[model samples]
Target chain A: MSLADLHFFKMTREPSLDALCAVVAERHAQGLATILYAGGTDWMVEQEMRAPLHDEPPLVVDIGRMGELRGISLAGDSLRIGAGTTYLELERSAVVQARAPMLVRMAKDVGAVQIQARGTLGGNLATASPAADGVAALAAYDATIVVKSARGERRIAMADLQTGYKKSTRAADEIIVAVELAPPPEGSPWYWRKVGARRAQAISKVALAGVAVVENGTATRFGVGMVSVAPVTARMATTRALVLGKALAEITAEEIDHAVDQDVTPIDDVRSTGEYRSHVARALTRDLLRQLGARV
Target chain B: MKISLTLNGAPRELDSAPLVRLLDALRGPLGLTGTKEGCGEGECGSCTVLLDGDPVNACLVPIGQCEGRAITTVEGLGEMAHLSPLQRCFIDEGGAQCGICTPGMLISAEALLRRVPDPDEPTIREALAGNLCRCTGYQRIVESVRRAAELLREGAAR
Candidate 1:
C-alpha cells in the first residue's frame, strides 16, 4: 500500500488549551470516543494497527498548538514543564540543562532528532507504553503530572497515574497540562539507563531510573523507577525501602533480589521474556547502587 | 483546511485535512518525490525534512502543524545540474547505496553542517544516527558528511 494510505477520518486542530479541553469535554458528554494527538510520532501507527478492530474512528484532537502547554518554568524549587513542550525544546533549553539535566538526557534518548523534534513529554506519558523512557525517567524524578479538563485540573503522582497496561488515572475528558518536577537533592547520585534493540530509534526492552544520596556512606534517600518490569512503569518501593538508611557498601544482592521481586510484576511479551527483564532489572538496580557507592 | 508554508524557498499553500502526513502532502499533491518513505512510521528517517530550519520526520508531522512554517525537502537542497555540496560529497564518496536513504541522509547532513560547520566524526554520526543506510554500512555516509563539512568551511561548497 502507498504510504499515503494512512489517514485519519476525523480530526480537529485545536488552537488553544481551553478549546482543546472544551472539545474533549463536549465529546465525552456525547460519548464520542476521542484520541488526543500531539506530535503523532507513534500515535498514527497505533491508530493504523487498531483500524481493523474498530467500526468507528476516534475523534483526533490536535492539541499540538496549545500555547499554555509550551514552555519550561521554575516554580520556586520545582520545575514546571508544559505538556506540549517538544523533546527538541527540552533538549535545547539551557534552563532544563541546569535544573534537570536528567530530563535533557532523557529527551536526547527519545528516538533521536526526528522524534525529539515532534514528540511531547505529556504525549509520551499519555501513550503510557509499559517500557517508555520518559515514564521511567519521570518516575525517577518523582514527578507529579498536572492534567486539566473543562471541569478543572488536578495533580497526579507519577507513581499513582498508571493503573495497568495502557490505562491510567486520567479520565477521558482530561488532558495533561504540565509535568511538575522537583529537582533531585543536591549531590545525590542518580542513574538512568534504557536497554533496547539498538542505541538509536529503538523501544526499551528494559528501562531503569534511580536516585540515591549517601551521607558519609549511609543511604539517606533512595528511589528507583523501572519500565518493562510490570504491566505499567513502576516505582521500586519495596526495593527502595530495603536499601534506605543502609550503608551503600553493605547492601546485599540477595536482599535486593528479593526486594525487586516484590516491587515488579513482569510478564512474557514479544519484546522480551519476563525472566530476562527480572534479571536485568535486578542487575541494573544493583549496578546503580554500586555507582552511587563509589561516588560517595 | 488551508495550510500555508514555504516549500523549497517558495511560498505555497495546501488544501487538505489537518492530520494528513507532510510526507503525503509532499508526494501526492505537491509532486515533490525526493522525500522517500521507507517506513511510514517514524522509525526510518527516509522522510526527514527541514521544518523551520530544524530536521524532523515528515511522516510524523501533520501539514496543519506546519502552517506558516518553512519546509525544505531534498529537492530544495539542489538540482541535478547544480548539485549542493552535500549531494556532491555523497556521490563522490559513495555515501548513497540503494538510493532510498540518500535523501534523508543529505537532509540530516545539511542540518548538521548548517548548525556545526566543523563537526567531528562523533558529531556527524550523532546527527545522522536516525537516518539508516543498510547498503554502505554508514562509513561512506559519515565520510561524505565530513567531506561536505570541509568544503563548506573552505567556502568551496554552497
Candidate 2:
C-alpha cells in the first residue's frame, strides 16, 4: 500500500484547553490511545514509514489551535512560553528574542522555514528526541515543562522530563501546556551550536547549549545542556561544577572533558558514535569558555 | 472531514480524511497534480505549499489542521497562459530544469516576494532554503528569484 493508505488514523479536534482535557480524560478512562497532534512535522514522517499503530487506531487529537497552549509572554521574571507556540512564532517574538536570544538562535536552526513554521517548543520537549534542539536549548535555561490534564497540572523540571529514549515523565493523559524559565542573566554569554550533517533541515548529530553568568572573570551561575550524547537530553552538572567558583580562563579543556564524560552516556547510533560525540562535547565546552569574553 | 480552505483564489471543500496529508488530499481527491512529491517525507520541498501565507511542506500538514485556512499551491501561483512573473523568471533563467522542484520553488518564491520584494541573494537563498533543486544548481534558482523580485518590484511601482 502507498503512504496515502497510512492516513487511516482517526482524529478529533478539541476547541479549548478544557475540551482537550475532556477528550484526553475520556480516552484515559477508556484505556485507549490518544496522540496529541500539534505540528505534524514529526508525525507525518512516522506515517510515511507506515509505523504500526496502537492496537486500536489511536485518536489523533488536534490541539494545535488551543489558545491556552499558544503565545510567549514574560511572567514576572520568567518567560512563559505556550507549548503550542510555533518555532516561527518564537523566532519572531520580540519577547523571546529580547529575553532569551538563545531560544531565538535555536529557533533559527530548527528545520528551516517549513518545519520552524509549524514545529512547537513544547512539542520539541514532548517529542523527547535525544537530539532535540529545543530541549537542549531550554535545558540550558533550566526551564520548567508545564503539563496539564483533567486531573490537574504538574511542572516537571527540564532535567527530569525525559526518562529514556523517546520516553518522558509525561503521562498518557497529560499534555505539555507551556514552558517557563528565567531568561539568561542579562549581559551574560549565551551559546548554542547544532553540529548537523548539513546546515539546514538535517537533524543535529550533536548539539551544545550553554549559558553562563560570569562576574569579575569568575563563573557565578551557569547551565550547560547537551544532546545526541546521552540516552536522553542532559545537562552537565559536573562540568558546571568544574569552574563554578573559579576563573573561566583557568578551567582547562581536559577538566571539562572529564566532567562531560561523567555527564553524557552517548552510544553508537545511526547519526553518530559515542567517541565523536564525546570529542565534540569537550570541544564545545572549550568553545563556550572562549566565548565568555571574560579575562582575569 | 469536510475541509473548507481557500485554494488559489477560490473557496473549496473536500470530503477528505482528517489524517490525510494535505499533499495527498490535494493530489488524490482534489486532483491538483502540479505539486509534485519527490519524497513522501517532508525533506523534499517538492510538496511545499503556502499554508495560511507560510510556506510549509504539504506532505507534513494534515487536512484536518487546514480548517478555514488559506492554501496556495504551485498551481495557485498563476495560470499557464498568463504566467506569474516569478514563474516566467524560472523558465527564462533555466531554474525549472527537471520540473520536480519548480512548483515548490515558485510557491516558496511567491511567499518570499510577498514578504520582501527585491530581496538580496542571501535573503532569497534563505527564503528558498527549504526547497531543494538537484538539476539546476541553487545558483540558477537563486538568480531566478532575484530577477523575479525585480519584476515584482517593478509591477508594484506601476
Candidate 3:
C-alpha cells in the first residue's frame, strides 16, 4: 500500500552522463521494473506505481542527483533545456520566455505554484498525457525530445514521440535527458489557452496553442495545435492549410470552423464529452485565428 | 535508508526509506504533525512546506530528494508562546475554521510574504492558488495574508 515495500532505491548523482545511463541499463538487464525518479512522482504514484508482485516495490533510480541534467541553455538555433528543470524554473527563465512565451504561459497554467515548482517537462513528455499543458505547448513549438541510453543518444520529434494514451516509445533502458526547442521566428504572435473544470489544479478539458506570423496582410507562417481533443497533441493540418499563406481578408470563419471539425477527433471521457470538446475545439480555433487575423 | 536534512532550522537525521513521503517523515519519525495530509494526493495543499525556501507539496516529495535541503514546516513559523505575525493575523482575521487547513494556509502565506511584502489582492490569490480552503471561503484567508504582509513590512521598518 505504501513505499515501505520498495526493495531498491538508488540515487544517481554521477557527473558523467554515461555513468547514469549505464546504471539504468544494468538495472533493466536484471529484469527489474525501473522508474527514473524525478520530481513529478505525484501522477506516477497514482497511475504507474503498481508492483508486478504486490509484495515488492519497483526500482526507482533518483536521477535528480545527476547535476549535469539541470540547466537551461541556448545551443545554436534551439533552446537546450535539461530534463530536470522544473516548471517553476521554466516560468522564471527569461531566455525561455523571450524565445517561447507560449511555453511560459502554459507552464504557469500547468498546476498551481506548488505543482509548477516540482513538475518537469520531461515527465510530461514521458507520461504522454493528451491533456498535459507542457506537452501541448511543446507540440505547438515542434520541440525535440532528447533521450539517452547506455548505447548512445537519439532525438524524437514531440509529435512522433507518444504512441498512445498513457504510453510512449521510450525504452526501459533509456531516460529522457532534455528537450530541444527551436525558437519561433522573433516576434511571432502566439496564443495559448486551457479550458478546465476550475481556475486552478484542474485538468484540461480542452487546450489550444496557436502561432502565426502575418506580414503585408498575408500569413507567412501559422500553426494551430490542440490537446485533450485527440489521441495525441496534434497540429490542425486542415486548419493550417486553409489559413497559411492566405491573405487575412480572404479566409472565411466557416472554413476555419470546418477545418477544426475535420482535423481533430476527440472521444468522450470523464472530464468532457466528445461533442463539447469538438464544439470548443472549433470555437477556440476560430477565435485564435480571428485574433491573428486582426494583427495582420 | 538514512535520511538527513535541515528541519525547522535544525539539522536532524532519521532512518526512513528514500521513497517515503516527506509528509510521513515529518509526521511520523520527526513528530512534526503540524503538516496535515488532507488528500494523500497533491491536490489539497494541506501538506504544504517550504523546501529550500520554495513552497512545495510535502505529500509528493520523497524524503530522499530533501537530503541537505532546508525544510520549513508550520512549526518553524511560530508556536503557542511566540506566535508568528502571520499566525496572529490569522487569528485576528478569523482565518482558522475547522483548523485542518490553517497550518498549510499559514505556511503558504508565510512563503508569499517572504517574497513579496506588499502584494496586491490578485498577487496574494495567485501565490495561494495551491492551498485550498473549503471553510473560510478564502476571503478571510486573503485578508490575513494582507495583514501579515503589513506586519512584516512594519517589523522590518523598526
Q: Which candidate wins on lDDT?
A: 2
Give DockQ: model 1: 0.64
Q: Is candidate 1 or candidate 2 better by DockQ?
A: 2
* Displacement of the residue A98 alpha carbon in candidate 2, Å: 0.6
Task: Supply candidate 3's per-residue lDDT for A37.
Answer: 73
Against the native complex, each candidate's DockQ, computed on alpha carbons, is 0.64, 0.76, 0.58
User: What does candidate 2's lDDT look like per residue over A1-296, in tens digits?
Assistant: 24645557777877788788888899789887788889988877876567555456778888888889998889789899999999899988998888888888888888878889889987887789988999999888999999998989999999888889989989888989999998865666899998988788888888998887888888777887888888788787888888685788787767777888898888888888888888888888778877884321
Per-residue accuracy of model 1 over A133-227 as CA lDDT, tens digit each: 88888888889999999999899999899998979999878889999987766545778888888888888788888766678887777667798
Highest TM-score against the true fold, candidate: 2
Worst 10 residues of 1 chain B by lDDT: B149-158
True contacts kept of 3: 0.46
- Name the docking class for model 1: medium
The 10-residue segment of model 2 chain A with minimum total lDDT is A1-10
lDDT accuracy of residue A169 in candidate 2: 88
How much of the real interface does each model capture, measured as fnat?
0.61, 0.72, 0.46
Candidate 1: the clashing residue pairs are none
Q: Tell me the TM-score for chain B of model 3.
A: 0.98
Candidate order, DockQ descending:
2, 1, 3
